[model samples]
Target chain A: MIGVELRLMLRRRRVWLCWVLLCALPTLVAILLATTRLAPPPGRGGAFLSAVVSNGQIFPAAALALVIPIFLPITVAIVAGDTVAGEASAGTLRYLLVRPVGRVRLLWAKLISVAAFVLLAVLFVTLVSYVVGVLAFGFGPDASIGGAGAIPSLSGVELTPLDVVGRTAATVGYLALCMLALGAVGLFFSTLTDSPLAATLGVLAFVVASAALQPLDAAAAIEPYLPTSHWLAWIDLYRDPILWTNLREGVLVQLGYVVIAFGAAWANFSTKDVTT
Target chain B: MIVATSGLTKRFGRVTAVDGVSLQVQEGVRFGLLGPNGSGKTTLVRMLLGLVHATSGSIEVLGEPMPRRARTVLPRVGALVEGPAAWDHLSGRANLRLLDAAGPGRARHRRRRVDAVLEQVGLGGVDRRPVKAYSLGMRQRLGIAAALLREPELLLLDEPTNGLDPRGIQEMRALLTSLNEAGTTVVLSSHLLTEVEALCTHVGVMDRGRLALSSELGALRTPTGRVLVRSPEPDAVVGLLDGQVVDRRGDTLTVRGAEPAALNARLVSGGVRVTGLTEERRTLEQVVLELTGTGNDRVDRRPREAVVPGRSRGAGGPR
Candidate 1:
């Protein structure tokens, strides 16, 4: 049933287009990095691939990862958020509900498809980061420390190529978790509203409001607990000493967000009178 | 019973859309739900399908409590509620294929079924065209095809003849008749009384959220013995009968107050010549309209009840 739902989502032209464009962003940026010499440090043609592959900070892939939470999540929210609302608006939800399927099963199929899309979006960012990062910076080893020295990094650790891949894979895995949670937020909002636009905007509003609230000095005490504040915690994966303490907490917090969103979605969707 | 509802009511905010309406549909019967605009026919249908919540009363479909979980009943029923049912971006065939894929029906055989229904609905050659490009009539046909994809045991169609040309209406009428003949129970709601009279075996007339009348098509029709008598001696007939007259035209009069013996005896005794006396009676349209107040002014003011039938289709389908 989930596979069937996923097939339907993939068949949607708008959703497919959004997925493809986001997937190609990193690849496009990598190509540009390889052609241009404006890359800082480790100068010259040889450094091009090395710099490009490891260029998560300046390349389009990294830019997307950063910019996506601000914009893409809203788009992601729209896709995930409109999953149910869009059907209602199109007058298709009633048709679907009349099928020989339970509401729980139907909702599950939809959620799974949305989760798949969210993973694809995260994988899009991760793959671009890996491809361009390796091509521009060389697979020599990700030695650069990200932000504070919390998690371990390959830059100064002198690890093997495979080890670096393993570490990056783990890091990408955590990032996927955070992204999936955001997608769930969109799903929850989608279940609440009958209008596709309202569902899409509602999810974005929650994320944007959280982002806005994170920097408020007056509410600094509660800022750490905000869902948006922990989005960047994936960077902790590239630290020198590997601070597992805060990293584990970030994962838990992300999971907590997923639980709340999905819980709300299920409760409301189960009872929401599908007027359409 | 294929479908049954008792005191089914739905209220949106403060307005009672459907109020205390009870209805029943027997198996293999083409039941027509008739009513004027805002009479809550659509709302009742929606609640029966579990598509909308009923504010009060209980509805049982296929011998099971409705809306408790529609899964058991949904598989046995197919419906097309107002307008074309399709994704505008998809081809007509693709829309059929999608619906076909969702149910227990086999996807491999779906193509053949899709084609058959399209052909039946007069949309055979345009399956490749995007649904958005189809004309209103074509779209309506496509919607019917989509609804028929599963070949369910029961079909609920709301004004399936809207936008159909003369030939299309004839075809649709034939198609519905054939479906009923094949043991597929049909419940259709239409404003065209003539259409219902032509196809449906049973009908339930609604008046402002209430079931005003429900009976077999044959029973609701006018008696077979009445005669339509037109004469140029209206005043003379009125004076001669002394109260047996039903209606007086410009110079004509309809007399249903006497049997053949009494009518002929009185006419002979009065020395009045009868020019024409046709035995044909009223139409279901006349009966429905008169009963529903659409034909109140024109209705025969005698003791017999006015059988109103014709009402806007909006009162029955999705509002």
Candidate 2:
């Protein structure tokens, strides 16, 4: 079942379209930055955008920040929301159920497929931006500051290229987990309705509502628990001595959402009548 | 028995879709479940396939309880419910291969199994065109091919020939008959009486969510004990038969109280030229119409009663 779901996902032209669009946004940003050479002043614009003009190694982090706010979530919601509801609307849900694919197994396969999409999207954006970043602004001239070739962290500490690579890998893993939590929420909505559009809209509404409430002082008591609150915690990965506080809290919160949302999906889907 | 359901009922909120339908299908017989539209035939089939859970009742397929043992039982049973459905973006062959891979089958045999079913369903020359490009008849054949991929012991089809042309329908009937002959019990649900009449050995009629009648096709169509006679001299034949002539239309008379052979002899002996003489048996259409009520799709308002000035006033007003 997992193999079938993965093949179906990879075979779709829409999945590839999503990857292209995701990579396109950062590449477009790279072009403007390379031509203008005008990096936003510190504490303005997307995180790491002010730093990308000097160190190309930090471009992946900057690119991730560019898409994470809206583009990444929208694409994740589209794919995840279509998981069960798309099949239902197409009238193939009943056939799969009768094919003797257990409901639990089908949900698991869908979760894995959604996770794969998230990983692929995140990885493509990072790799494309990395190449674009290096070409637009060659490896930084600050190699003499620390050992051989080193880049400055968010702090004044100069870190080697190897350290930057390791931190970017950690950043990739963290962002994937955050998107997966959103994917689980989308999966739950997918099981609630037979219309894929409706399910996708529901997930968007959820993200929008959560993000809308995050900045309000009135919502401060429940701030840390919101699904979107921990999404930006990956920025701390660039600290000289990694800031584990928000990173650890972010991992725990995202894991909580994944468990709860997935549990709800399994509970609802296993008992659905599959009338379609 | 291939399938047995006792007190099977399903309710969708306020509407009862299937009500107390106890059905039995014998092994090795082509069972046709006949009903009008919205008479619960689709719901019953979905329940049997475990696509829709029953509100209350029990269903047994192939001697094992349904849904509970569905994983073990369903692989041996193939079905096409409501109509055919497939991923419109993929070719018929690709769709079959993917569905075949979804179950417990071995990977090496998937190609052979898919090809065999496609050939069986008359799509041997099919190309790589996606299902979205296939005509309705081609799509229906593809659906059947998917069902046949597992070589199941029992085949449950709902309106199997829905989108087929005349020749396609005939080919489907022949295919099902040959499958039954090879020890596969076939169960099909259809609203088309002619399709069932030509294909089924046993019949079950559904009316308003209830099983109205079930019996062998040959048994429900027993001789009606009336003989039809056609003679050139209608007046002489009617006069000769007298009280035995139940009905008359031109030169043809429906006569009772005599066998076809005896009636023919009497007509010939009476100096009447008998063109045709045959016993009248009940047709499947007649039996079905007699047993079932009007299809649920129809709605008729009751006639208002005329009110006298002195009678109760409420009864005459518009409802």
Candidate 3:
């Protein structure tokens, strides 16, 4: 049933085109980042891509975070938002449901499809960013110890290229999990609303609102727990001795969200009348 | 019986969509569910297919409880509900192929069945065209093709004639008849009385979430011997024989309590001629309308009503 669902979803022009964009967008951005080298003013090259510096962790992370609220979430939103509503609106849902496939199988198939799209989008962004970042700045690991900090030269790290790539891939995997949570939340919203715009915007609003609160001094107490706050925990990958606490908490929160979102979506979708 | 529902009931909040309706579809029976709009026909079909949960009562398809084990039963059933709603972006063939893959099958069997059903439904020519480009009638045919792909033991069709041209309806009727002859039980819903009259062996009429009438079509035919008379001189005939004019539809006359033989005898005797006289065979449409209580608007008022030339209102009036 899932195989059929996946095949049907992939056949849609919107889904397929979005997937192509997901694969290409990051690569295009990477090319721009690498080729359009805007040198930092004076001694600013020493500063890592942090939030405060013109070209640092903050710049790239903010860009990536912005992409999260927009770019990456669209893939999640398209797949998730289309899951039930698309079927209902098209009338194919009745046909599919009348087949041997159970509601559970249908929901799982959609969840898996959304999960696959999330992974594809994240990998696209990571590969393009890594290749472009390395090409522009050199193929070495840079360190941004904290927010607004300097990105140390890669010449000092003792790790082999293999170790660095392996660590970077692992970090990418963690980030993918965070994005997967967004996909699940988007799916939950899709089940609640029949309009794709509503579902997509609903998920984006949640992510953007959380990100908006992170920098506020008064919301400092809740900032650490926000999906947006932990979104950049991947920066810990550059730390000489990576701290697993933030990564662990991020993974836990993401997992919790995925479980809850997916559970809600499943529960709502299974019992949904699907009148459309 | 292939499918049976006992006291099936479904309610949405305060409104009941299907209210304690019992239905039985026997093996190889071509059952027609007839009703006006909002008569709960679709809701009942949904319940039988386990798409909508019944609020109260039992439903068994092929002797198994519905919904609880609907997956097991679904493999043996096929349905085309409302219309053929497919992924408009996909080619018509791809849509059929995708639906075909939902059931258990091998690659070759799936392809063969898809091709066979497409051909059967007369969509063989437009297999590669995007579904969005197909006409409404063609889309309905494609939906039937998708439904018939598996050759299931039971088939459920909802408004299958809708959007179909006359030729398409005839083809569909013949196709369903043959499928039933080959041992597949079918449950179809349609507002088109002609389609049901020409195809179904049994009919069920529903009104306001309740079954108003259910029986063999043969039983609904008005009793024989009552002749339908159409004459411009209805007054002369009425005055000569004092025959009760049951109803007047344009120049036609429905005279009850009178035999054609007696009416003919009295007309000749009184020198009042009748232009046309034919035996009235009640159409399924008339029976359905009257059974559903939507025929009350039909004015049967005429002073020359009740009483016939040869037969009185007492014993064997017409038949």
Candidate 4:
């Protein structure tokens, strides 16, 4: 059943369109940065945009920063929100249920498929930006004090290229988890309504509301619990000593959301009458 | 019994879709569930397939408790509820392949089974066009093909012939009849009276969420205790039968209280030429209409009393 679900997701043109559009944004940003050679001031623009002008190897991290705020979440919400409600509106949910596919089993397959999309989208953005970054700005000169072929960390400490690769990989994993937390929320909303558009909007509203409240002093008490609050914590991986404080808190918070949201989804779906 | 439901009922908030429908369907019989629009036929079919949970009752299919053992029982029972539905972007064949793979079926014979069912449903010559491009009749056939993918022991179809043309309807009737002949119990819900009368062996009529009548097709069409006689000399036959003649139309006379054979002998002995004589049996239309009430779709306003200036009380008026 998982295999079938994956096949169905892979065959959709809309999924591929999402991947193309996601890659397009960062590539466009890389071109403008390459041709014009104007980098956002340090500590002002995206997490690593200013650094990418000197070392293209860090562009993948910069690209992650570019999309993490908006592009990635929108695509994830669209896919995850469409999971069950899309099937219900298309009139296939009842057929699948009667096909002897247990409701719990179906939900499991859908979640796994949504997880796969998140991993692939993050990986594709990381990979495509790496190639674009290298072509637009060749590898930086070996000028760092740490060693030859090393890049500078956000903490003013020099790091080797191999270390850069390892940090980027960690960043990818962290961002994927964060997006999955959002996906789980989307899944819960998907089970609540039969319109895929409605569920997708519901997830978007949730993210926008969370992001909106994160900055207010009055909301500071609940800020730590918001799902979007920890999304940028992956940038901590680039620190010289690797700030584990926010990263650890981020993992726990995202894991909590996944569990609670998926639990709610299952509770509502298992007993659904499937009138459609 | 292939299917038995006791006090099966389902309510959607304030609306009672199915009300205490204790239906029984025997094996190897083509059971036609006759009803009007909004008569709860689709809801009942959905419950039988375990798609809709009963509000308070029990359902048993293939002698196993439904929804509880649905994983085991459902594979042996195929169903098509409401109208046909498939992924609009995928071809009919692709849709079938995906649906077949979702259930517990032999992976080795997946392609073979899909092809065979498509052929059985008369889509053998279909091309690779997406389902969105297929005609309504083609989609209907594809829906049936999906149901037949497992060679189920019992087939439950709701409005199975819904979008088919005249010839397509004929072909479907033939296919269902052949499948039933091979020992598969067939149950179909339809609003078309002629469709049921032509295809079904047993009948159950539903009205306003209640099962009004259920019996063998033959039992419901019992003789009406009258014999119809057609002769060249209609007056001679009427004169010979005297007061037994209940109705006269052209060259035929409806005579009560006599069998065809006895009536024929009497007419011939009385020097009357009897061209045709046969006992009258009730038509299915008459039987269904008699058992059921006005269809739920109809809404009539309250009748108003007549106001006349000079007419006294007890005067005749439209009731």
Best by lDDT: 2
TM-score of each: 0.82, 0.95, 0.84, 0.93
Best by DockQ: 2
* Model 3: number of backbone collisions: 10
lDDT of 3: 0.75
What tens digits encode model 3's per-residue C-alpha lDDT throughout A1-276?
A: 778877776666776677567556544554554566543453343223321222322233323443554567667766777777777777888888886667878878888887776776666665655544544444333444432223332333454445556666776688789888888888788888777778877887888798899999999988777877787677666566777789999999999899999999989888776555
Task: Put down candidate 3 lDDT per residue, B145-179, tens digits, no spaces.
Answer: 87787788999999988898889988998899999
Kindly report which residue pairs in candidate 4 clash with one another: none
What does candidate 4's lDDT look like per residue over A129-233, in tens digits?
A: 998987787677765554335678999898888898899999889999999999999999999999999999999999999999999999999999999999999
Q: Name the top TM-score candidate.
A: 2
With candidate 3 superimposed using the best TM-score fit, by how many Å does residue A56's alpha carbon deviate from the native?
A: 14
**Would you list the rank order by DockQ, best first?**
2, 4, 3, 1
User: What is candidate 2's CAPRI-style docking category based on DockQ?
Assistant: medium
lDDT of 2 by residue, A54-147 (tens): 8887899999999999999999999999999999998888888888789999999999999999988999999999889888876787655433
Model 1 lDDT at residue B80? 77
Task: Note the residue pairs that clash in candidate 2.
Answer: none
TM-score of chain B of each: 0.80, 0.92, 0.82, 0.92
Error (Å) of candidate 2 at residue B212 is 0.9
Proportion of true inter-chain contacts also present in candidate 2? 0.73
List candidate 2 segments past 4 Å from native: A143-149, B242-251, B301-319
Per-residue C-alpha lDDT of model 1 across residues A205-226, encoded as one tens digit per residue? 8888888899899889977677
| B189-299: candidate 2 lDDT, tens digit per residue | 999999999999999999989999999999998889999898889999888888999999988889988988888888899999988888899999999999888888897
lDDT of 1 by residue, B26-59 (tens): 9999999887766777777778788788889999
